[model samples]
Target: MKITLIIPTYNAGSLWPNVLDAIKQQTIYPDKLIVIDSGSKDETVPLASDLKNISIFNIDSKDFNHGGTRNLAVAKTLDADVIIFLTQDAILADSDAIKNLVYYFSEPLIAAVCGRQLPHKDANP
Candidate 1:
Protein backbone atom coordinates (compact mmCIF):
# COMPACT_ATOMS: atom_id res chain seq x y z
CA MET A 1 0.00 0.00 0.00
CA LYS A 2 1.10 3.56 -0.64
CA ILE A 3 1.98 5.14 2.69
CA THR A 4 3.10 8.60 3.78
CA LEU A 5 4.90 9.30 7.03
CA ILE A 6 4.52 12.74 8.59
CA ILE A 7 6.58 14.13 11.46
CA PRO A 8 5.92 17.38 13.30
CA THR A 9 9.02 18.97 14.74
CA TYR A 10 10.15 22.12 16.51
CA ASN A 11 13.79 22.58 17.49
CA ALA A 12 14.32 18.83 17.49
CA GLY A 13 17.89 19.21 18.83
CA SER A 14 20.27 16.26 19.37
CA LEU A 15 17.63 13.53 19.49
CA TRP A 16 16.49 14.16 15.94
CA PRO A 17 19.29 12.12 14.42
CA ASN A 18 18.28 8.97 16.26
CA VAL A 19 14.75 9.31 15.00
CA LEU A 20 15.92 9.89 11.44
CA ASP A 21 18.35 6.99 11.56
CA ALA A 22 15.68 4.64 12.84
CA ILE A 23 13.30 5.80 10.14
CA LYS A 24 15.95 5.29 7.50
CA GLN A 25 16.27 1.69 8.63
CA GLN A 26 12.57 0.93 8.59
CA THR A 27 11.83 -2.51 7.10
CA ILE A 28 9.00 -1.04 5.06
CA TYR A 29 10.34 2.15 3.57
CA PRO A 30 7.76 4.89 3.39
CA ASP A 31 6.75 6.08 -0.09
CA LYS A 32 7.08 9.62 1.27
CA LEU A 33 8.27 11.28 4.49
CA ILE A 34 7.07 14.77 5.24
CA VAL A 35 8.45 16.82 8.10
CA ILE A 36 6.09 19.58 9.17
CA ASP A 37 8.46 21.97 10.89
CA SER A 38 7.20 24.60 13.28
CA GLY A 39 9.97 27.14 12.63
CA SER A 40 12.86 25.19 14.05
CA LYS A 41 15.76 27.43 15.03
CA ASP A 42 18.14 24.52 15.03
CA GLU A 43 19.69 22.07 12.53
CA THR A 44 16.63 19.92 12.05
CA VAL A 45 16.31 20.76 8.39
CA PRO A 46 19.96 20.26 7.58
CA LEU A 47 20.02 16.90 9.33
CA ALA A 48 16.78 15.67 7.79
CA SER A 49 18.00 16.61 4.31
CA ASP A 50 20.58 13.84 4.52
CA LEU A 51 17.80 11.28 4.15
CA LYS A 52 15.89 10.33 1.05
CA ASN A 53 12.09 10.22 0.63
CA ILE A 54 11.75 13.27 2.87
CA SER A 55 10.07 16.60 2.26
CA ILE A 56 9.89 19.65 4.53
CA PHE A 57 7.03 22.01 5.16
CA ASN A 58 7.69 25.05 7.34
CA ILE A 59 5.10 27.03 9.28
CA ASP A 60 5.06 29.67 11.99
CA SER A 61 5.23 28.29 15.50
CA LYS A 62 2.17 30.28 16.53
CA ASP A 63 0.08 28.49 13.93
CA PHE A 64 0.68 25.04 15.33
CA ASN A 65 -2.18 23.08 16.84
CA HIS A 66 -1.27 19.43 17.38
CA GLY A 67 -4.33 18.09 15.57
CA GLY A 68 -4.70 20.67 12.83
CA THR A 69 -0.99 20.82 12.05
CA ARG A 70 -1.02 17.08 11.56
CA ASN A 71 -4.15 17.38 9.48
CA LEU A 72 -2.30 19.74 7.18
CA ALA A 73 0.31 17.12 6.52
CA VAL A 74 -2.37 14.53 5.86
CA ALA A 75 -4.01 16.78 3.33
CA LYS A 76 -0.76 16.91 1.40
CA THR A 77 -0.84 13.12 1.07
CA LEU A 78 -4.09 12.82 -0.80
CA ASP A 79 -2.81 9.91 -2.82
CA ALA A 80 -1.57 7.87 0.10
CA ASP A 81 -3.54 4.79 1.11
CA VAL A 82 -2.36 5.16 4.70
CA ILE A 83 -0.83 8.04 6.63
CA ILE A 84 1.47 7.52 9.61
CA PHE A 85 2.18 10.34 12.05
CA LEU A 86 5.29 10.36 14.19
CA THR A 87 6.73 13.09 16.38
CA GLN A 88 10.38 14.18 16.37
CA ASP A 89 10.75 12.95 19.93
CA ALA A 90 9.85 9.37 18.97
CA ILE A 91 12.63 6.85 18.59
CA LEU A 92 11.56 3.86 16.54
CA ALA A 93 12.37 0.65 18.42
CA ASP A 94 13.02 -1.57 15.40
CA SER A 95 13.04 -1.71 11.64
CA ASP A 96 9.62 -3.39 11.70
CA ALA A 97 7.92 -0.75 13.82
CA ILE A 98 6.29 0.85 10.83
CA LYS A 99 5.61 -2.47 9.18
CA ASN A 100 3.85 -3.63 12.32
CA LEU A 101 1.48 -0.70 12.15
CA VAL A 102 0.84 -0.99 8.43
CA TYR A 103 0.21 -4.74 8.63
CA TYR A 104 -3.32 -4.24 9.94
CA PHE A 105 -4.55 -2.55 6.78
CA SER A 106 -4.61 -5.90 4.98
CA GLU A 107 -7.58 -6.87 7.16
CA PRO A 108 -9.82 -4.40 5.26
CA LEU A 109 -11.71 -3.39 8.40
CA ILE A 110 -8.79 -1.50 10.01
CA ALA A 111 -9.06 2.07 8.79
CA ALA A 112 -6.16 3.39 10.86
CA VAL A 113 -3.51 2.07 13.25
CA CYS A 114 -1.06 3.39 15.81
CA GLY A 115 1.62 1.97 18.07
CA ARG A 116 2.01 2.30 21.80
CA GLN A 117 4.05 5.21 23.12
CA LEU A 118 6.75 4.08 25.51
CA PRO A 119 8.33 6.40 28.06
CA HIS A 120 11.91 7.47 27.57
CA LYS A 121 14.44 5.21 29.26
CA ASP A 122 15.40 7.86 31.81
CA ALA A 123 11.87 8.71 32.86
CA ASN A 124 11.25 9.08 36.59
CA PRO A 125 8.42 6.57 36.61
Candidate 2:
Protein backbone atom coordinates (compact mmCIF):
# COMPACT_ATOMS: atom_id res chain seq x y z
CA MET A 1 0.00 0.00 0.00
CA LYS A 2 1.15 3.50 -0.88
CA ILE A 3 0.24 6.80 0.77
CA THR A 4 0.89 10.43 -0.10
CA LEU A 5 1.72 12.54 2.95
CA ILE A 6 0.96 16.23 2.46
CA ILE A 7 2.11 18.84 4.95
CA PRO A 8 1.00 22.48 4.59
CA THR A 9 3.53 24.86 6.06
CA TYR A 10 3.93 28.62 6.53
CA ASN A 11 6.79 30.14 8.56
CA ALA A 12 7.03 26.84 10.42
CA GLY A 13 10.79 26.64 10.76
CA SER A 14 10.70 26.01 14.50
CA LEU A 15 8.24 23.12 14.17
CA TRP A 16 8.95 21.59 10.76
CA PRO A 17 12.16 19.87 11.75
CA ASN A 18 10.32 17.94 14.46
CA VAL A 19 7.62 16.99 12.01
CA LEU A 20 10.18 15.76 9.49
CA ASP A 21 11.96 13.77 12.17
CA ALA A 22 8.69 12.13 13.20
CA ILE A 23 8.04 11.26 9.56
CA LYS A 24 11.43 9.64 9.29
CA GLN A 25 10.65 7.54 12.35
CA GLN A 26 7.37 6.19 11.01
CA THR A 27 7.30 2.39 10.98
CA ILE A 28 5.71 2.51 7.57
CA TYR A 29 7.09 5.40 5.62
CA PRO A 30 4.84 7.13 3.12
CA ASP A 31 5.54 6.55 -0.54
CA LYS A 32 5.73 10.30 -1.10
CA LEU A 33 6.09 13.38 1.10
CA ILE A 34 4.70 16.66 -0.25
CA VAL A 35 5.42 19.89 1.59
CA ILE A 36 3.21 22.79 0.45
CA ASP A 37 4.91 25.97 1.57
CA SER A 38 3.21 29.37 1.66
CA GLY A 39 6.06 31.78 1.15
CA SER A 40 8.00 31.11 4.31
CA LYS A 41 10.53 33.84 5.17
CA ASP A 42 12.59 31.44 7.27
CA GLU A 43 14.79 28.54 6.13
CA THR A 44 11.72 26.31 5.67
CA VAL A 45 12.15 26.21 1.91
CA PRO A 46 15.88 25.48 2.01
CA LEU A 47 15.43 22.89 4.73
CA ALA A 48 12.68 21.13 2.83
CA SER A 49 14.78 21.10 -0.32
CA ASP A 50 17.62 19.49 1.58
CA LEU A 51 15.44 16.60 2.78
CA LYS A 52 15.99 13.41 0.77
CA ASN A 53 12.45 12.00 0.67
CA ILE A 54 10.45 15.20 0.59
CA SER A 55 9.06 17.11 -2.39
CA ILE A 56 8.55 20.83 -1.80
CA PHE A 57 5.93 23.02 -3.45
CA ASN A 58 6.73 26.66 -2.82
CA ILE A 59 3.68 28.87 -3.33
CA ASP A 60 5.00 32.40 -3.67
CA SER A 61 1.76 34.32 -4.14
CA LYS A 62 1.10 36.97 -1.49
CA ASP A 63 -2.45 35.71 -1.22
CA PHE A 64 -1.38 32.17 -0.43
CA ASN A 65 -3.56 30.53 2.22
CA HIS A 66 -3.62 27.13 3.88
CA GLY A 67 -6.82 26.03 2.18
CA GLY A 68 -5.60 27.01 -1.27
CA THR A 69 -2.15 25.55 -0.71
CA ARG A 70 -3.61 22.27 0.54
CA ASN A 71 -5.96 22.10 -2.45
CA LEU A 72 -3.05 22.52 -4.82
CA ALA A 73 -1.04 19.81 -3.08
CA VAL A 74 -3.97 17.41 -3.14
CA ALA A 75 -4.48 18.11 -6.82
CA LYS A 76 -0.90 17.12 -7.54
CA THR A 77 -1.40 13.67 -6.00
CA LEU A 78 -4.88 12.73 -7.16
CA ASP A 79 -3.65 9.35 -8.29
CA ALA A 80 -2.58 8.28 -4.79
CA ASP A 81 -4.72 5.67 -3.06
CA VAL A 82 -4.63 7.56 0.22
CA ILE A 83 -3.76 11.19 1.02
CA ILE A 84 -2.55 11.94 4.56
CA PHE A 85 -2.99 15.62 5.34
CA LEU A 86 -0.75 16.71 8.21
CA THR A 87 0.11 20.06 9.72
CA GLN A 88 3.70 21.25 10.03
CA ASP A 89 3.41 21.29 13.83
CA ALA A 90 1.91 17.82 14.14
CA ILE A 91 4.09 14.92 15.18
CA LEU A 92 3.27 11.24 14.99
CA ALA A 93 2.75 10.00 18.56
CA ASP A 94 3.59 6.43 17.65
CA SER A 95 5.72 4.90 14.94
CA ASP A 96 2.72 2.90 13.70
CA ALA A 97 0.46 5.91 13.27
CA ILE A 98 0.69 5.77 9.50
CA LYS A 99 0.34 2.02 9.46
CA ASN A 100 -2.78 2.22 11.61
CA LEU A 101 -4.28 4.86 9.34
CA VAL A 102 -3.66 2.74 6.27
CA TYR A 103 -4.91 -0.36 7.99
CA TYR A 104 -8.31 1.21 8.56
CA PHE A 105 -8.79 1.62 4.82
CA SER A 106 -8.66 -2.12 4.27
CA GLU A 107 -12.39 -2.20 4.80
CA PRO A 108 -14.08 -1.95 1.41
CA LEU A 109 -16.79 0.39 2.70
CA ILE A 110 -14.41 2.81 4.36
CA ALA A 111 -13.98 5.90 2.25
CA ALA A 112 -12.17 7.96 4.88
CA VAL A 113 -10.92 7.66 8.43
CA CYS A 114 -9.83 10.16 11.06
CA GLY A 115 -8.05 9.56 14.36
CA ARG A 116 -8.18 11.30 17.70
CA GLN A 117 -5.38 13.77 18.40
CA LEU A 118 -3.92 13.87 21.87
CA PRO A 119 -3.74 17.41 23.25
CA HIS A 120 -0.25 18.82 22.84
CA LYS A 121 1.35 20.19 25.97
CA ASP A 122 1.79 23.57 24.32
CA ALA A 123 -1.48 23.69 22.36
CA ASN A 124 -4.57 25.51 23.46
CA PRO A 125 -8.07 24.83 22.21
Candidate 3:
Protein backbone atom coordinates (compact mmCIF):
# COMPACT_ATOMS: atom_id res chain seq x y z
CA MET A 1 0.00 0.00 0.00
CA LYS A 2 1.09 3.56 -0.64
CA ILE A 3 1.22 4.98 2.86
CA THR A 4 1.59 8.70 3.27
CA LEU A 5 2.44 10.13 6.67
CA ILE A 6 1.57 13.70 7.52
CA ILE A 7 2.86 15.66 10.52
CA PRO A 8 1.95 19.18 11.58
CA THR A 9 4.86 21.01 13.11
CA TYR A 10 5.42 24.29 14.88
CA ASN A 11 8.52 24.72 16.97
CA ALA A 12 8.27 20.99 17.84
CA GLY A 13 10.76 21.82 20.60
CA SER A 14 13.70 19.51 21.41
CA LEU A 15 12.06 16.25 20.46
CA TRP A 16 11.81 16.80 16.72
CA PRO A 17 14.97 14.89 15.89
CA ASN A 18 13.91 11.88 17.88
CA VAL A 19 10.53 11.91 16.17
CA LEU A 20 12.06 12.04 12.71
CA ASP A 21 14.64 9.40 13.56
CA ALA A 22 11.97 7.07 14.85
CA ILE A 23 10.00 7.43 11.63
CA LYS A 24 13.13 6.89 9.58
CA GLN A 25 13.87 3.72 11.50
CA GLN A 26 10.44 2.23 10.88
CA THR A 27 10.49 -1.18 9.19
CA ILE A 28 7.90 0.10 6.73
CA TYR A 29 8.89 3.63 5.92
CA PRO A 30 6.10 5.80 4.58
CA ASP A 31 6.09 6.32 0.85
CA LYS A 32 5.67 10.02 1.48
CA LEU A 33 6.28 12.07 4.62
CA ILE A 34 4.42 15.37 4.46
CA VAL A 35 5.43 18.11 6.85
CA ILE A 36 3.25 21.18 7.19
CA ASP A 37 5.30 23.64 9.18
CA SER A 38 3.65 26.69 10.69
CA GLY A 39 6.37 29.29 10.78
CA SER A 40 8.59 27.53 13.26
CA LYS A 41 11.36 29.59 14.88
CA ASP A 42 13.56 26.53 15.32
CA GLU A 43 15.19 23.82 13.24
CA THR A 44 12.03 21.86 12.54
CA VAL A 45 11.80 22.82 8.89
CA PRO A 46 15.47 22.53 8.05
CA LEU A 47 15.84 19.24 9.80
CA ALA A 48 12.84 17.69 8.05
CA SER A 49 13.97 19.06 4.71
CA ASP A 50 17.29 17.28 5.06
CA LEU A 51 15.59 13.92 5.20
CA LYS A 52 14.61 11.77 2.24
CA ASN A 53 10.98 11.13 1.21
CA ILE A 54 9.84 14.23 3.13
CA SER A 55 8.01 17.09 1.45
CA ILE A 56 7.34 20.27 3.39
CA PHE A 57 4.74 22.95 2.76
CA ASN A 58 4.97 26.24 4.66
CA ILE A 59 2.04 28.08 6.19
CA ASP A 60 1.81 31.07 8.52
CA SER A 61 1.39 30.24 12.19
CA LYS A 62 -1.70 32.42 12.28
CA ASP A 63 -3.39 30.18 9.72
CA PHE A 64 -2.90 26.87 11.52
CA ASN A 65 -6.06 25.00 12.43
CA HIS A 66 -5.89 21.46 13.79
CA GLY A 67 -8.47 19.89 11.52
CA GLY A 68 -8.17 22.22 8.54
CA THR A 69 -4.39 21.93 8.32
CA ARG A 70 -4.54 18.16 8.44
CA ASN A 71 -7.22 18.08 5.76
CA LEU A 72 -5.06 20.27 3.60
CA ALA A 73 -2.17 17.88 3.98
CA VAL A 74 -4.39 15.00 2.97
CA ALA A 75 -5.47 16.87 -0.12
CA LYS A 76 -1.85 17.15 -1.16
CA THR A 77 -1.67 13.41 -1.60
CA LEU A 78 -4.46 12.24 -3.88
CA ASP A 79 -2.92 8.87 -4.70
CA ALA A 80 -2.16 7.55 -1.25
CA ASP A 81 -3.85 4.29 -0.29
CA VAL A 82 -3.45 4.99 3.41
CA ILE A 83 -2.97 8.32 5.08
CA ILE A 84 -1.37 8.42 8.53
CA PHE A 85 -1.63 11.60 10.55
CA LEU A 86 0.71 12.39 13.39
CA THR A 87 1.90 15.25 15.54
CA GLN A 88 5.50 16.33 15.15
CA ASP A 89 6.47 15.09 18.60
CA ALA A 90 5.11 11.56 18.24
CA ILE A 91 7.96 9.09 18.37
CA LEU A 92 7.46 5.50 17.25
CA ALA A 93 8.41 3.11 20.05
CA ASP A 94 9.78 0.42 17.77
CA SER A 95 10.73 -0.35 14.17
CA ASP A 96 7.66 -2.51 13.66
CA ALA A 97 5.19 0.15 14.71
CA ILE A 98 4.28 1.23 11.18
CA LYS A 99 4.58 -2.27 9.82
CA ASN A 100 2.22 -3.56 12.45
CA LEU A 101 -0.24 -0.78 11.79
CA VAL A 102 -0.23 -1.43 8.05
CA TYR A 103 -0.78 -5.12 8.56
CA TYR A 104 -4.29 -4.46 9.79
CA PHE A 105 -5.32 -3.13 6.39
CA SER A 106 -5.00 -6.59 4.94
CA GLU A 107 -8.38 -7.33 6.47
CA PRO A 108 -11.06 -6.27 4.01
CA LEU A 109 -13.36 -5.01 6.75
CA ILE A 110 -10.75 -2.75 8.39
CA ALA A 111 -11.38 0.78 7.24
CA ALA A 112 -9.01 2.51 9.63
CA VAL A 113 -6.65 1.95 12.53
CA CYS A 114 -5.06 4.03 15.26
CA GLY A 115 -1.85 3.45 17.11
CA ARG A 116 -1.69 3.69 20.89
CA GLN A 117 -0.15 6.77 22.39
CA LEU A 118 1.80 6.62 25.61
CA PRO A 119 2.53 9.46 28.00
CA HIS A 120 5.97 10.99 27.92
CA LYS A 121 8.34 9.50 30.45
CA ASP A 122 8.92 12.93 31.98
CA ALA A 123 5.24 13.78 32.27
CA ASN A 124 3.83 13.96 35.78
CA PRO A 125 1.78 11.00 36.87
Per-prediction backbone clash count: 0, 0, 0
**Best of the two (1, 2) by TM-score:** 1
- Cα lDDT of model 1 by residue, 56-112, tens digit: 999999999999999999888899998998988788999999999999999988887
Report lDDT per candidate.
0.91, 0.82, 0.91
Model 3: CA > 4 A from native? none
lDDT of 3 at 114: 98
lDDT of 3 by residue, 35-110 (tens): 9999999999999997778899999999999999999999999999889988877788899988999999999999
Instruction: Compose the digit string of candidate 2's lDDT tens values, residues 1-125.
Output: 66999988788857677777788889888888898887789877777775556788877768578788888998888778998998877878888999999998898999998866676677768
Residue 67, model 2: lDDT of: 83
Q: Which ten residues in a row have the lowest lDDT in candidate 2?
A: 44-53
Worst-scoring 10-residue span by lDDT in model 3: 116-125
Clash pairs, candidate 1, are none
RMSD of 3: 1.3
TM-scores of the candidates in the order shown: 0.94, 0.88, 0.95
- What C-alpha lDDT, on a 0 to 100 scale, does residue 65 get in candidate 2? 81
